[model samples]
Target: MQKKSGLRGIHAGWYAVVCVLVLGLVALVLYGSGAYDSWRDGRSLDQACDGALAQDGLTSALGSSHLKAEDGDDGSLAGCFVKTSPGTGRAVRVTLRWSTDGAPSGSLVWYNADTLGVREQAAPLGNGWSGVVRYDGTWQIMVALDCANQKNKALVAYGDLYGASSGTALTGLGRVTTETAKKAAAQHGCQVKAGKRLTRVSTARLGEPGTAKPLGQAQGSCVALRDVPGAQSGTPEIMEYPADPDAPQTNCYLATSAKKPGYGLYAYYGAAAKDFESVGFGHPGGDYVLATAPCPRSTHEAAFALYRLYDRDTGNYPVPHYSDSFARSALKAFAEHEAEQRGCGEVRIMSAP
Candidate 1:
């Protein structure tokens, strides 16, 4: 009888253990399923925010007259525009926004448009947020929804929609007032005024490179020059085409001496008909000579030839002057001219000195 009692007690203990395990499994399953509903609600909110952000980007683009709305998939949100400038080449700016609502836990992610990968993530903002993105030669502006309770993520993606513009930097003043934000949005469109000034000669030094003249004395039509302090050694070497075996190509070598090599400027010119034929500067029936040379090193170096082959028969001559104070102006003018010749409308200038 005592042995029977011991067996019964052991069986009761095992039954209690099994009951606890079954209850724990049930609890786990309930929590997992219950959490999904909340996730779905959050995801719905995220989709709404994405739509709103997309509208904002489109409104900014259309209202500013920078782009026309293109046909897209139903419920899809995207917009873009093309811009052109005399100095800067062509570029397109686009904006895109998307979201995920089903994840229960709130999360926001920022992505680089080119890679389409997350660049940042955090809790959603209460009102909205914006980011600037660059891919290839394009620039994008992205804005997203600021969720109140859950993490609602939105994005404003801008593409380099138009040709290049003078000012390349995309500034984010973070959390600006609606009016200010609207102005910034308008800026992304073609209606946005151009803020970058092209390279020009100093008014006071219009005809005088060596002399320090009054600020207003320089010419307004001058080209922008690039500063190459160690160009003799550090400057990129110029590459020449096979047709023009004797023509100087764009080349730069760093100066090895302690004393920097005096600045070497180039005067770009379109050769005359015979000269063009002799050096292969121009094709058959082309009137302009495509040539560049080191500018004469002088304090008073005032003028450099600027030429453009408009067509086989016509060419343009825009004289780009040089000034010590406006050294970059000439370089910019020449670079622009080169871009135009190459049929490139946009150019990027790095801020590195």
Candidate 2:
């Protein structure tokens, strides 16, 4: 009887050990799975949250506000308002949408994106991209992204940031905007990263028809002249936020050469020069011996200078004789281009001195 009892005890001990081992294996598997999920969550947060939380950056961009997205508008717009507190009224809202069809045209995208690129490079983050997008009435930050390895879709962020003019505020909203994009990156396969780059305006000037390549579009930049030693080149400079804020004043110098003993060209911006018809460009009235003309109904000015008062090499010049015709042609083409791109009104020609 004593031997049977000891045998039963030994069997029970073995069973206990077996059960312990099985439970240990199960716990290990669960822990491993949980650990893997945690890792994935961290990575996912990096894409959307990391860049948005730069408190000390130049823009002092919007940090993690714990925003939650609900169903967006019915018209291809998926957006969420950043509430002041959970389940309460909202303060700021950031929203985004992507579309393959009915997307903004490439040139239109280029026109609007060019300005924002200058305004905000890192706003809050970069998606490995270089441009932005815009719509009518309100100014917003936009980006072009590729979804699902196919060349498709654009990302547009609009903050109802009306009457707000702080750079901090602008970029703060921008950060939220990009964070929203990162959250969608995985679902849409927004494979391409984004960054900022200035839109390049082509340097080629107006030449004879069919001979010279057309100049690249300059949205908010001044296509004016900056002199180098050997040959003339186009120097484009950002003149305020023309496209983004739609600043009223802007100019484009069609052509320019070096100082005296060289050649030169000039253009009028949003300046109104009177006495141009009576006094003329070369007359003793204004600076640069530059011809002036009324822009008529358009608030923007019009005029171009080929051989201003102080031009040198007056003897062996390439384009000689009254270049008014030249200025007219260049100005006409530029005005037309602006109308086509920006819907600027007619630039009726007035007389030159």
Candidate 3:
């Protein structure tokens, strides 16, 4: 009986030793896989933008669980440089800036891209967010949030990726911009119309002659511009957003050839309109014509412009001059059509200077 009892005690001691060893192994695995580090570094990136940039799903997109921020400032603009782990072969570097005047205050040529690629038409990020995204080799996003009391200004979050990227990375960038804009608006005491959580966005990057159709068969975006002169001529194409009035800005690019853009029409409402006029963009002159109409969303009038297309190399207007008379007629038609779509009244087209 004594020997049997001793054997039972020995077996219990061995069982306890095995349990401890197994637990130690499990802990070693967790630590080695960096699961512990992930928890520690999870909220690190949020510190830069005043807790505006959410780190959720960014780790997977960036392919690193570790991130750091180098905070910066430029005049009134708040900026940040976000990077992946220090020594990773595949790294992502994103620079973000936000301010009331971050967007272009004045430019007839507003088709801009941060990355090194041909500029393509940007698509609107729907789901109640007033923003547009363009992807070339890299991506750029701009979100304009309207203020309730400060009608003349808006909080704009603009950001672009600098290095390696993927579809997930694009979505992650959108998340960063959206979250930062919302947080900044709140901090500045702007009762802004908040956007919903961004789950998905369009990746379409259409270049010249986008979504083309014969002018005779014009519909959708080109329908409003169909009555312009030479509608029955060589293939003309257009690119535009779907009829959406709540959007703060609208773009329409009309191309007379398959190779190049012909005319660029733009509408700026609310804060964007203010930004446009503040920098002498909406002034009637140059190779472009201007128009204005009152909009419900803005305390001031919305501004529109029709710019003549030119060759980048020579900086000269296209051959045949495309006619100034044609430009005026086209501007009037496009302005009236766009104003009507936005529920605005009486577009007052300005004479060319």
Candidate 4:
């Protein structure tokens, strides 16, 4: 199945954490060199959701008429996002599939808020799992199948989201998911066991918190990111190390809420060196919004700093700016704090590392 796609509570088992920490750093360095962004150019969003309404089994089964849909593939993801005619409020419907055929090991199969769990109701998708997740005013009905074709094995999931009041919400969506899973199973020649239900997942095991949550509580190395002055809280971004194992993770506490939209407070621990630009921010003619200083520790320290980018061309995020003074000040404050913690040098206009 194709579909796509953190740190901070990182204090226990120092040795194990360090190894993973280094790996995480290596990944971030590559990311800094521009290996981030999982979405690659591909079929237009329309192509991704090619048969959304007309060809989908769920719509007719659910008695959803006059519904509208849009779908597409973004390198790693492919699916349709739908809303009823005159879609309004939080009510919506979505169908997503990872476009990638070969997902690397350790890739996540389910994510987003209000995680899904299994409940017994019916068995339609022969040989997989069925679950449901309800949150706010919306709910998602999900199904996954283990389709193996002699050699390669793939796990594919199908889901539907809708208001709880829809008549066939349960029965129809479940049947549609089962039908879709059957088609998918046959496509991959994998067996599906009818009526097999997943064990209930505990509420205690809510979805894993990642960058989408508040940066303050999101995980990080050394110290968690505290609230920044004059900034609305935004999600922290965790750059994972793609090297075989996790190590040296880079936890970026974004102050995107910084009266400006692109300010981010990046912290990375586990062995790493500072690049000249990061190390040379305060000097004449260096980056205007970027700055960095070495974290005091020889092993685990926050040495990297960056002023996150907001592409005006995409008009994606609100345009943001951080004065050279503010950026430098933040870096200086961060470095001084690190020195005190690691018993290193007094913070000054730090020299190039």
- Residue 256 of model 2 has an lDDT of 28
Error of 2 at 79 (Å): 1.9
Better of 1 and 3 by lDDT: 3
State the lDDT of candidate 3 residue by residue for 87-152, as single tens digits: 454433333333345443212234332111124345667678877776555667777777777755
In model 4, state the lDDT of residue 237. 30
- What ranges in model 2 sit over 4 Å off? 1-70, 86-90, 103-129, 132-139, 162-165, 196-220, 224-353
What does the lDDT read for residue 270 in candidate 3? 68
Candidate 2: tens digits of C-alpha lDDT, residues 1-353? 99999999999999999999999988788678675444443443343332232122112222333333333343434544333213333234444555433322221232221111121111212333322322233335544343435443444444433333345554555554554565556555566454443222121112212322212333332222222211233222211112321211223332223212112232322211111122243232212223333333233244433332222224343323334444454444444444433344555544443
Candidate 3 global CA lDDT score:
0.64
Over the stretch 1-353, how does candidate 1's per-residue lDDT look in tens digits? 99999999999999999999988888777677765444443343234322222223222222232222222222324333322211233333333323331211111111111011111111111122222222233333333322222222222232333432223222211111122223333433312111112121111210113322221222211112223342223222221111111111121111112212112222212211112223222121211112232222111111222121121122321112223323343344544544453333443332211
lDDT of residue 67 for candidate 3:
75
Instruction: Write down the lDDT that model 2 would get.
Output: 0.36
Q: Where is model 1 poorest over a 10-residue stretch in terms of lDDT?
A: 112-121
Cα lDDT computed for each candidate against the true fold: 0.27, 0.36, 0.64, 0.36
TM-score of 2: 0.34
What's the TM-score of each model vs. the native? Answer: 0.22, 0.34, 0.73, 0.30
